[model samples]
Target: MSQDLYELSATELSASYAAGLDPREVAESVLARIADREPVLNAFYVHEPEQVRRDAEASAKRWASGTQLSAFDGVPATVKENIPRSGIPVPSGTALANPPVSAENAPVTDRLLEAGLVLLGSTTMPDWGMLSSGVSSRHGITRNALDPSLTTGGSSAGAGAAAAAGYGPLHVGTDIGGSIRLPGTWAGLVTLKPSAGLVPLHAPYMGRAAGPLTRTAADAAALMSVIARPDIRDYSTRPYPSMDWFKGPANPAGLRVGLQLDAGSGAEVDPQIAAAVQRAADLFAAAGAHIVELRPFMSQAQLAGIDAFWRTRSWADYSALEPEQRENVLPYIARWCAGGKDYDGVATMVHYNRFAQVQQETIAATRDYDLVLSPVAPMAAFPAEQPMPVDDPDLPMAHISFTMPYNMSGQPAATVNCGFMLDGRTIGLQLAGPVGADDKVLAAAVWFESVRGDAALDWARVL
Candidate 1:
C-alpha cells in the first residue's frame, strides 16, 4: 500500500499503515506538499503550523505502536475559516465578519479532531461566505485551479481549490445554498451537503447543520461518521449513527430517479451541461434504475427568497464588526444590510413563513422520487477577478438560483462530476434526498461513483 504524495485518497492513506506504509511518513509528505503549494493557491486563512506538527508527531508514535485512532487516523485535512478553530475568528468570508479569534474549538472541529484527522489550518472564504463568486475583499479571491481566469465557486472556494490543487484529500465545507456544491462543481471535485441536522452547526447563523467537501463521495461518508456526533452545544443535531454510509447493504435496483431537466431558472443552460446530465441519466437507466425527466416544482425566485431567514447572513455577519472597519466591508453586502437597516422584526417573520410555504410545496412535489437529479451550477466558471458574466447578452447569470431550494427545504444533497463542457470547464450533476435521509444521499452518491468513476479533466489540460 505504498502511496505517492498526491494520488492516495484520504481513506487509502490511513489504510496504507495497515498494509506497511508508515503513517508518520505520509503525514510528513503531506506537510511538505502543503508548503509546496500554499503560495500559489493561497487556500488557507489561518494555518496552525506548530500545532499540526505536534499532532502529526503524536500520530507518528501511534503508528509505531500499531494503535491508530481509526481509518482516517493521521490524515491531514482543513476546515473552512468560519467553522470555529479554537483560536481563529469566525471570519465568515467577509472583512466585517471577523471578531476576536475564538478561544475554544467549535463543536464540529472538536468532534473531527477526536476522530483523528489533524487540522492543518483554516481555509479562506468569501466574506460571510455568502457571495457566490468566491471573491473575498479581505483575503484576495480564491482562483479556480483548473483555470486561473475562472472564478472558484463559493463560499467554500478555498476548500474546493485546495483539494483540486493537491492540498489535502478531505476537508469540511458548509452549504446553505451551493456554498459547498458550487465550488466543488466549478473546481472539479466531489462535495456533500448532508441533510440539515445530520452535521451539527453551533454557529448562530448556521442554525443546525454542516457538511463535507472532498475529492470523492466516499470521503464524504467517512467524514460523516467523524463529524455527525450529537453536540450539546447545538441541541438540534441527531445522535450519531452507529454506522453511517457503509454501502452495499441497500440495493439500488429499480430505484425511481427523477431528473429535474429544467430547474426553473429560465437561464439557457449551456448545451454541453445539458448533454452531460442526459448522459448521466442514460447511465442510471442502464444500471436498472428508472429515470424520468420532469419539470421541477420550485421556482428560482421562491428558492432565493428563502434567504430572508437563513441568510440574515449579511446582518448576522456584519453587524458584529467595528464601526470603522464596516466601511471597508464588501460594498454590496454592507450597503444592503448595514446601519441597522434591512428588516423589521415583523417582516422577518412574514418572510420566514413565505419561505416555509415554498419548502412545503417543493417537498410534497418531490417525495415520489428516491433521488432527484439536476445540474450543480447552471453555468460554468467565470474569471476570478471579475463578477460572474451576468450580462452575457444571451443569458443573465443568477447565481444560486438552482441551489437555494434545497437549503430552503433542508434536504441532503451532493454533486458528482459527469463530464466537461465544450469550453473545457467541468459540469456536475446534483443528487438530492429527503430531509433526514443523509445516509441515503451518500449511498446514491457512492453508487454514482461506482458507475461513472472520477472526472476525466485535468487542471493543465483545461486552464
Candidate 2:
C-alpha cells in the first residue's frame, strides 16, 4: 500500500493514507523514490536520510494515535533552496555576500511542518532566483525530468523536476518570474504562483513569493491554506478568509474569462501552442465561462521596445556580481552583459514608464474578466545543451517573453499543460487574475486540468 501510494501525488497519497495505508511506511517508500531518482535529476542538494525517517516515524505514530497534524502530515515535500531552513546554507549560486538562512523557520515552511509535511530537503534554484532557464554555473544545471535534453524553467527548476520525477508527494517552489508555473508547465505538473506577497519570502531573497508545484491543483490550494496565514515577516500578505478555501474541489462554472492572443511583439505563437490555447478556451466556454477574446495592453511596436527594455534589467541584477561570484554563470548570461554597460538611466526609465502604462491599461481591461489567459512562452521548452536559443535576440529578455510583465505587476499567475506540441514537448498556457483572486484563478485551472487530463506533462517515459 505504501509503495502504491508513494507513486501517487500528495492529494492521492493523502486520500490513500486516510484509507489505511501505514503513514510511516508510505513516507519510507517516497524516500526510496527520492534515493532512486536523485542522481540524474540533481533535484536535491542536501537531504539527510536519518532526519527523514525520524519525521516519517513521528508522523506514523501520530496516525496510530489518531493525532494527524493535518491532511499533509506524513507527506514528503521539497523546499526551494532559497527558502531557508534553519541551518541550511543558502548559496543562491552567486556571491554578493552569502545570503544567510533565517534563524527561525520561514512562515511557509513552518506551516508545512505544522501540517506534518516531511521536508525532504531543498531543491535547486538559479542564483538568487534570477534568470528564465534552469542552467546555472553555481549548482550545475538542473535538467528537465521529461527530457534531460530540454531546459527546465527557472529559478524553481529543481522543484519542477522533483514533481515530474515523483520524488515526493509535493514539491515546494517559489515564483517571481515564471519559476513555479514555467517548470511545472514544462514538466507536465500543476503549479501555483500566489498573488505577490501572499507567501512570506524571508531571509535569503526578500522580494519573491513562495508556492507549490504538484501533480494536482488541489494540493496547491491545500498548501495555500496552510501558508497564507498572517506572518510578521511579510508585511504585505493578504488577509482573506482562507479557512473555507480548499474546503471543496468545486469546478468553475459561468466564470468570466479574457484571452490575450497577440503577445505584443508579433512573435508568432507556435501552431500547436495556439491550438492548446483554443482548447483551453473551449473548456472554459463549455463550463459556462463567458469567453471574450480581446487585445489588451500590447501592440507590435510596444512589445518590440519592451523586448529590449526588459532584457536590460537583467543586467542590473547580474552585473552586480563579481567574476569570482559567478564561477558557474552560464555563458549566455555573459553574452547578454556584453553591451549592457552602455545603458543609461534615461533608457531604463523609458522602459519602466512603458511597463507602467501597459499594466495600468491592462488593469482596466481585466475589470470585466474573472481570468485572463495566454500561452506561457512564445516557444515550447527547447534543448537543454544549447547555451542560447538561435532566436536569442528574438527572445524578449532572452527566452522568457510572456511571463515577466505580470511578475512586474504583482498579479497572481499560473501555467499548466494546454497540450502536447508536434515535437513531443508540452505547451504551457498561462492564465492570470488581479492580485488577490488566487483561489478563483486556481479553480479555473483545476477545471481545465481535469478536462486536459492526459495532456498534462511528465517525462517519466522519455527520461
Candidate 3:
C-alpha cells in the first residue's frame, strides 16, 4: 500500500484483510506511529506492543484461513482507560485509589474483542474523568495531536490525541458532557456520543455513553455497528435496533436545521468558531435545507445547578477514599470536589433536580427541527496544562453549556470537523437530534462530511 497502514480507516482495513493483507504488518505500522508520536502526545496509559503483535498475528492466521471473527477483524483500536477490560486496572485518571483489575470486560470492550479488532491498549483521562481537559493526576497532560501547546480535550483526552496522531482507526471514548466531542473538535475527528444508553455500558449513569472517536464518520459507524449491540448488564439502554449506519441522508434538502449560536450562558463563543458554524449552516441552506435560528435554551441557573450536583457527586466519591489517597488527587480536581462538601441534602436534591429542567428545555427547544447545529465548545484549543477552558476549578463547567444539555436530554449528538482556524486548529460543529435519533444524527454527520471535504491540517505532520 502506498499510504502507511497506520493511516488506513477501519473500512479500508476491513477490505484489505478480506484481500489478504497481513494484520501483523498493520500492527507494525501502528506501533511505528506510536513510537514516533507517544512521547510527544502522552496519549496512552497502557500500550503493550508485544501484546499488540501477538493479537495481530492471531488475527493474521484467522484471515489466512478465512475464519475472521467479523468484517473488521484485525483492525487496530484503543479504549479509554476508564472503560474496564479484564485484567486491566482502570486508574480512571486519579492516583487517589488503587483499583483492582477487572474480572470481566465492559460491554464496549467485550464487543470490540468479540468483533476481532486488535486492542492497541487503553488511553488516558483526567481525575475521575471529571475535567473536560487533559491535565491529569495519573497521566499528566495529553497534548493535542494537531498542536502540542494546546489540549486534547477530555476526560477522553488520550483517546482524542491517539486518534488525531494516527494511532489506528478506532477509539472508544466515554462522554457525559462533551468529553468525546470536545476532544474530537480539537483533534479534527468525528466523535459520536450516542443517545444515552444506545451503547451498553457497565456502570451506566444518567447521561454517560461510550462512543467512537475516529478520523472519519464511516469508521465511527463501523465501530457503532459492533458496540451498539445490547448487553443485559446495562438496564438503562433502549432495545437494540437494526440500522444501516454507513448510509447517510441522501441530501440536506427539505430538512429543517436549527442554527444555535448561543449556549444560553457560559463562555462566549469565539468569533472564529461562530463564523465556522455559520458557514456550515450556509452550506446546508445552499443544499436546500431550511435553516432556522435558535434562541439560547440554557441559563446560568441551570448550569450552576448541574455544576453543584456534580461537585457533590465527586465529593461523595472522594470522601470514601482514605486521607492519603485523597491527597494524591489532582489539586484542581480535589478543590472542585471539595466544593460539594458544603451542600446540604436539600441543596443537593435541588441541584440534582435541575437535570430534569435542563432535559425539558433542551427537548422542547429542538423538537421542531430535524437537527440542531452549534459549536462543540465555546473556544478553540487552550493550554494543555489547564484543566478546562476557563482554567478555574470553581468555573469548571463553564465551557460545556452547548454539549451538556443534550446529555441531560438523552439526545444523540456528534461532532464533525466543519472548519479550521487560521492557525490550523479545528473547529467542531455539533450536530444533535432528538432522543433515540442516533441513526439520524450519524446520518447527518456522514452527509456533512461529504461536503466538508478534507481537513486542512495534515495528519502526517503531527509534532
- Per-residue lDDT tens digits for candidate 3, residues 1-463, read 8999999999999999999899999999999999998998999999999999999999999999989999999999999998998888988998755677888899999999999999999999999899888888877889988889999999899999999999999999999888899998888989999987789998999889999999988899889988998898999978746767877554789999999999889999999999999998988899999999999999999899899899999999889888888888999988998889999999999999999999999999999999999999989998898888888787648889999998889888999898888888899999998877777788888888878765434566764
* TM-scores, each model vs. reference: 0.90, 0.88, 0.98
Weakest lDDT window of 10 consecutive positions for candidate 2: 386-395
> What local distance difference test score does each model get?
0.72, 0.71, 0.90
State the lDDT of candidate 1 residue by residue for 206-312, as single tens digits.
32246787777777787887887777787666654454576632346798888876777545577788888888877778888898776766665554345455445
Per-residue error for 446 in candidate 2, Å, reads 2.2
Give the number of the best model, judged by lDDT.
Answer: 3
lDDT of 2 by residue, 184-205 (tens): 6677777777776777767423
Compute the lDDT of residue 60 as modeled in candidate 3: 96
RMSD to the true structure for each prediction, in A, is 3.3, 3.1, 1.3
Which rank order by TM-score, best down to worst?
Answer: 3, 1, 2
Tell me the deviation in Å of residue 419 in model 3: 1.4
Between the candidate structures 1 and 2, which one is better when assessed by TM-score? 1
Which of candidates 1 and 3 is the stronger one according to lDDT? 3
- Return the clash pairs for model 2, or none: 73-116, 137-328, 146-459, 188-457
Better of 2 and 3 by lDDT: 3
- In order of lDDT, best first, we have 3, 1, 2
